[model samples]
Target: MNLAAAHPGFLSPTGVEIVFVLVGVVTLAAAVITVTTRKLVHAALWLVVALGGIAVEYLLLTAEFIAWVQVLIYVGSVVVLLLFGLMLTRAPIGDSPDADSGNRPVALAVALASAATLVTVVVDAFRTYWIDLDASVQGSTAVTGESLFRHWVLPFEALSVLLLAALVGAIVLSRKDGPRAAGPGPVRDPDATGPAAPAAPDQPDTDTGPGSGTDAEGRR
Candidate 1:
């Protein structure tokens, strides 16, 4: 018996497949807009949509734990932190002319090459693999948690450290220097002669004989 005949073929997609395709389209559109939009804030918002769509796709794949984790970590924390950083840095709210570098063609070519490589790799790797969604929970909380902590714990902790360092670096970069501590008065030349003659004491006014007489009655 052919293994391919043991399951539903791709020609007749199930409801989950249909929903997944729809969500994937929306996610792709959002991602495209996120990259192509000239407004930074709009791009950030569109990224939220794209990320949320991915979380939805995860949910459709029956990975409930991973879906919630994606929502909380990426949609809730990461996107919110990104928007907060933008606000803190006082990023341009309107259309930013500097949003695009002068290397669009080069960037597009690189992006296309990277995308093609990734797609080819993923398709080649999973072309024959199939998941039985109805059989059992493939990614429950316990299973995912165990796998993560058991096998990927070191990398996970390292990523956390890297994120913390990035957050600190962002804070340091965004901070405005404190009004430079009032500069310790002006610097004095080490070779200056004497104590600068105490600024010459105010000279006492001398009376110009009888013609310079000033009376208390305001007559001079």
Candidate 2:
């Protein structure tokens, strides 16, 4: 039977699930590009894409609250922090300098294994479960606020403190040093033996020593 069209129960759910899958694919693609791309800014941009894709998936999962929070925190704030880091570090706009390291292959292997394990766990847990919605389960904004203040407030405050600390630390780290202490250099007296004296008329005449520069009066 046509459960979606006849009962109108499956339309939103199916559409949401389809969008979730599409966003998930985009997330994976962005994550791969984020890791493999050589440019630091490009990697940060791909990170935004991955993060935004996750936010979209969260919305599709009927978690509008989480989705918006993700958009505000990760896409807006965290990625901006990443950009700030790049700017302070003076990351070159051209190709990344020695971005890839010897352990890249091992990191990729571990990532793939982790992905496989997560997929297995999710599939094993929810393969047969079906989503059923009657009336929407309304989430109260006040409840969310109160819960955030009550339970997770410390971590949230700590995160703000951490970001502020990072900004201060970046400022400290990126500052160029001032001029060094200049040791006492050689001092000279303007008149002290710069040139030889002129010869007396009756005395033996002597020419100036080697490589002498005449003064304004032309005597050396």
Candidate 3:
């Protein structure tokens, strides 16, 4: 019944929208893997993929500065720091038995509740609002910077401090203790000449005393 004519952009999305949906799906899958993986390194790598997808979404939304910031901060710096922390803590390279504590059902329930809450909140907030693709809403660096520093300055600073604290906590947790004693080793006598050099292993009486030795021509 002419749905494209009735709803216009909603029914007939552009190529950007198609790409956005694809990216969003990929991001969601990566996020699920990030949370559910049994290996921490795999989870961190999946987190990078998810964050990279979000950055691509931002770029698709015409926010290049935010996209780059997302890539630089989350994907680059944060993931590298996370990998370093994992290395420093001697985390397992393969599947970590401690990663999943047999609480999958409970965790899944909590995750579903959180997702529902978030979806509800977002839907309620933006149900009646819509942005036109033809609008000239400039998402420039200056505007973004002003908005960040003016209205969200306190939260921004708080986030930075939070990240700093998290980094410090990671370092603290990954720091190793002093070397441990490897138990008592074989004790040697200081006055002994290294156990008499093992008595030369009893070389078959090769030199039959001083005169009984055989010459190079086999003559005694």
Candidate 4:
């Protein structure tokens, strides 16, 4: 009688399968939009959608811990940090045309090639594995995290160092008096404009008329 308990949105077997397909579709669409969106904030929103789709997939697979982690690490921390960076750096409020470049064709080609390679590898590797969806899934945040730290300690530390370095770099670069010697900065577009007026040669030694050059000329 109660459809909510019997065949909820995505908890039932059939619903899970259908939702997986939907999630895949939305995830792909979000990926495309994340890249193609002209606005920086819009791109960030699209990334959130993509991440949410990942969380949904994890949940459908009964990996609630991983799903929450997908939301926490990606949707929460990473996106928040990105938006913070955008805000702090005073990015243009209007559409950021250069947020991405004009190299869409190249980017798309690279993405397609990567996707094809991934598909081939996955298909070849899993051609014979029978995955039983009835299998019990463990969703332990602590265990997975411990395993990650234990196995990939070096890469984990490296990533932490990388993130710290990036934050420090952004702070240094955005400082009012950025990290640079107190010297004249490089010239911009020198050929685009007329040559700068030649610096005046060091003026010849000047004299204060009578007594100024007394030591030089022995004139008292």
Candidate 5:
């Protein structure tokens, strides 16, 4: 028997599949705009869109818990943090001239290579795997909680620590020292045992007047 005949559902596309594909396209476009935009704030906003799109995709996949987590952590916290950091650091809100660096070509090449490698690896790994929507939910809160705590606890804790470090670093970098207060007079040491030094007397002024210079020359 042919493969399509053996698996009719695989050959036919469902409404969920269509929506998933559409959301994925939008998410990819938003991500591209996020990286390519000249305005830093706009890039951050686009990132919000991309991250929100991912949350929607998770919802469509019936992973409601994961979707909410994505929204809460990434969309709400991470994006807000990024915007705050940008504003705190006084980053250019308008179009930036130096947004594109001289090494962009090299960066682009590396990004493309990494993306290709990741795509290839993922496709190869999941070529035969398929989720059955009709079956029991796989991404429920209990299941996710168990998996996370049992298998992925270390990485999760590490990510939390990393985020905390980034927060602290941003605060440190953005903090500005206040100017020192000006004093009215010179500061003196209070521990000195000797008598206080007396102030110097003002010097008297001497003028070599014309008649005085002539009298002095005659005397010489």
Candidate 6:
């Protein structure tokens, strides 16, 4: 007997499935726009939409913990940091001519090839696999915590380190590349390498004596 025919409820599409499909489509569209948009700020905003859609999908899958984590970590923190970097770097807010280049065809071909490879791999891996609703595997808080700490702890820590490094790098790269402007003090010459030479003291005029003026000009 066919499993799908035996389980009629599983075969039937529900309102949840329809909503999921709609959200997935929106997510895909947002992701495409995020990558293709010429305006950096608009691309960042579109990325928020795409990330939010993924969080919603997680919620639909009954993984509330993961969904909230996604929202907090990716949508909230990461994107905000990205925007902060953009602002600090004084990036252009409007359409940028350099955003798109003449190698668009080559990039598109590479993207399509990567996507096709991913799809083929996934199809081959999960073609006949089905998840059981009653299985012990779950996305509960305790289970997620255990799975993360017990199995994926090192990778998680590494990712945190990576993010920290990226943040530091952004700040470093955005900083002005010269000495800070002098405040209310003497302006030091930036090109001077050694200690400043002592300014020559003013010398009193030896030729302007009391009698020297009379000799040069008797009329005076």
Per-candidate TM-scores read 0.66, 0.61, 0.62, 0.59, 0.64, 0.64
Task: Provide the overall lDDT of each model, using Cα atoms, as 2-decimal numbers.
Answer: 0.76, 0.69, 0.72, 0.69, 0.75, 0.73
lDDT of 5 by residue, 67-138 (tens): 999999999898997886686445877899898899999999999999999999997675555567768887
What shift in Å separates residue 62 of candidate 3 from its native position after superposition?
2.1
> What would the per-residue lDDT of candidate 6 be over residues 1-220, giving only the tens digit for each residue?
3543454354566677778899999999999999899999989999999999999998778787899999999999889978866764457888887988899999999999999999999977754545453456477688899999999999999999998998677545433222353254334455322332222124244224322433333322
State in Å the error of residue 74, model 6.
Answer: 0.8
The parts of candidate 2 lying over 4 Å away from their true place are 1-13, 133-135, 138-140, 149-220
Candidate 5, after superposition: displacement of residue 198 in Å? Answer: 38
Question: Which residue pairs collide in model 1, if any?
Answer: none
Best by lDDT: 1
User: Can you write out model 3's per-residue Cα lDDT over 135-163, one digit (the tens) per residue?
Assistant: 76446588788888999999999999998
Which is superior by TM-score, 2 or 5?
5
TM-score of 4: 0.59
lDDT of 4: 0.69
How good is model 5 by TM-score? Answer: 0.64
- After superposing candidate 3, which stretches have Cα over 4 Å from the reference? 1-9, 117-121, 124-128, 146-220
Model 2, global lDDT:
0.69
lDDT of 2 by residue, 13-44 (tens): 57667777888999999998998888999999
List the candidate 4 regions with Cα displacement exceeding 4 Å. Answer: 1-15, 141-220
Candidate 6: stretches off by over 4 Å: 1-16, 133-137, 149-220
Of the two candidates 1 and 3, the one with more favorable TM-score, higher being better, is 1
- How many clashing pairs per prediction, in order? 0, 0, 0, 0, 0, 0
RMSD to native for every prediction? Answer: 17.9, 18.3, 17.9, 15.5, 19.8, 17.7
lDDT per residue (tens digit) for residues 116-160 in model 4: 999999977754444455666555677677778799899999999
